[model samples]
Target: MENARRTTLADVARAAGTTVPTVSKVLGGRSDVSAGTRTRVMRVVAELGYRGRAGRAVPPDAGRPPFVDLVLSGIEGTWANRALSGVERAAADAGVEVVVSVTRPPDDAWLTRLLARRLRGAVLALVDTTPDQLATLAAARMPVVLLDPVRQPPGTVPSVGAANWAGGRAAAEHLLALGHRRLGVLAGQRTHLYSQARVDGFRSAVTQAGLDLADDRVVHTDWRRAPSRARAAELLRGADGPTAVFACSDAIALGVYDAAAELGLRIPQDLSVVGFDDLPEAEWATPALTTVHQPIAEMGGAALRMLLRLGTDQPPEAPREELATRLVVRGSTAAAP
Candidate 1:
């Protein structure tokens, strides 16, 4: 019996009447290739039953453990901890290790260091990755997935996040249902896409209810406890203070609690609060926080799964996957006084 020869990129290119470099470009997911050319090249690749070079296939052995890079903006808060836990759990299930990295500035040096590791892929959580950084990853043929990116990444990149808009609307509706017309929102940084969606959704709900959300009532603060606390203090101390506050994150909501304390306001009794991202702190708060339960851990796990798929040369089913968010009623909210 004769042995079948393994298919090669050159063979596929010749069959498609294209150059080897063109086939390589198409397989590399480069944007420079025209849509028609890409389709044609992929068709030829399929018809030839061409898999990439043997080195490209995922190793079947259990000898050396593979690692995926999990990059974050910072790893200091409950939100970060929850997300990291999810990613680590998923990675464990897949028998892969996670190398967690914090990209404060997300500079080229970080990319360089990551590339040096020769990781299988990378999952970036709450990190605002730049185009150049993405280009470097692409050049290295490394798959990348974004988890709650501060901004929408390029169309080619896959992302996992929560339904921030719906969560925001739910928060506003909950407060509105409690007969709280005067409301304030402690939003995260303006640059965060989720933060903007949340604010927009909240604003939409308020407008639909024929209520006005004044500009001053919507304060944008850093996504940290201390900064949010300071901003909340400003809102709470204002003469036209809000009777109810909707914080974009539980951390921010905690800040609201601090501000209320400084101003001698009691939770639910004096000031009603609603928060997003139902972190552990939400349940531990004095009055417990009524918050939108964003599946932070699920998002992390989903991103890791997507990265794994990409590592195997599989395109994601969707460019963006948004986990659902639900409102969890807790002890912090009450009817307006």
Candidate 2:
């Protein structure tokens, strides 16, 4: 039997006839390595089976770069994935390395540690951090960017987000144009600023059209599938319920669709529905879903850029950025009964 090539660090070290630690140190890029020793060790490594870390193998770029940190919530969600991709792309273009941490509501100890370490920049993805957390972030003197609007007054910190209000208005206008006079609104969590903005915009357009928005017509939901579906089921089964529904999110709209089916109502013919957030699944739903499209990718990119700028100076600049939204008409809506 033939023996396999017995490649070992000793073999390479022997080829150079140097100490084992010298070869190991040179391969590890230890600064103590003499130039002549480094060249010899590298030559032996090329002749042997040894490989170095890829990042070390690549030559360093010549430029001054900024460091960024991204603190996101719910990394598993579809929307969060899309937003993260955008942020990564922007950070790469700026030659900044982004250190990311997943953050949750009501706890900020992790943030305090990161701040104590003195990072160059940080961004908060659409998470509900407490006012105390915001104050802590401010006191830490890190340049912070809020992903979605917070309950705090405007101009508190730089924020870049979708024009949720415009999205709401667009959704309402689409339904109204379809002759949907009697409407039902399924709102998301009231604590969420974007959700509240959407609800207010919908209500504004509905009232402007001279339609009476009865107290019963609007329902507050937690934006989860089971609860929203249960609430929608009740509304659909009622005798005087709305002929049209405007759900604040695609998740809520899905519940409405399920509820309408349980009540034996056909979309468009018997009930019209409009939704916010044109998620990928929106178009694939039965009868399709008419919805408002927010520029989710652009929102993420803008937030990253804004945070990068803020890191240079920690002054409290309330930069309010609004990305445009559009109405997408699909098969789910039609003239009201």
Indicate the TM-score of model 2: 0.77
Q: Where does candidate 1 clash, by residue pair?
A: none
- What are the clashing pairs of model 2? none
Residue ranges of candidate 2 with Cα displaced over 4 Å: 1-66, 116-118
lDDT of 2 by residue, 1-337 (tens): 9988655667778997898888766544355767666556656665564533222322224564556677777676467777777788889887787778886555444454455443566777776765434543443345678776555433567888888888888888888888888788888887888888998888889989998778777788886666899888877776777899989888799899989888988998999988887878688889899998877777888888888776333454478888898989999999888
Residue-level lDDT tens digits of model 1 in 1-337: 9899887778978887889898776655456667667556656655665656535534434678888999888888788898999999999999999998887572334555565565788898888876645644553456789999889787777899999999999999999999999999999988889999999999999999999999999999987788888899999886669999999999899999999998999999889999999988999999999999999999999999888877545353537899999999999999998
Which one is best on TM-score?
A: 1
lDDT of 1: 0.83
Provide the overall lDDT of each model, using Cα atoms, as 2-decimal numbers: 0.83, 0.74
Per-model tally of clashing residue pairs: 0, 0
Residue 221 lDDT (model 1): 97
Residue 134 C-alpha lDDT in model 2: 52
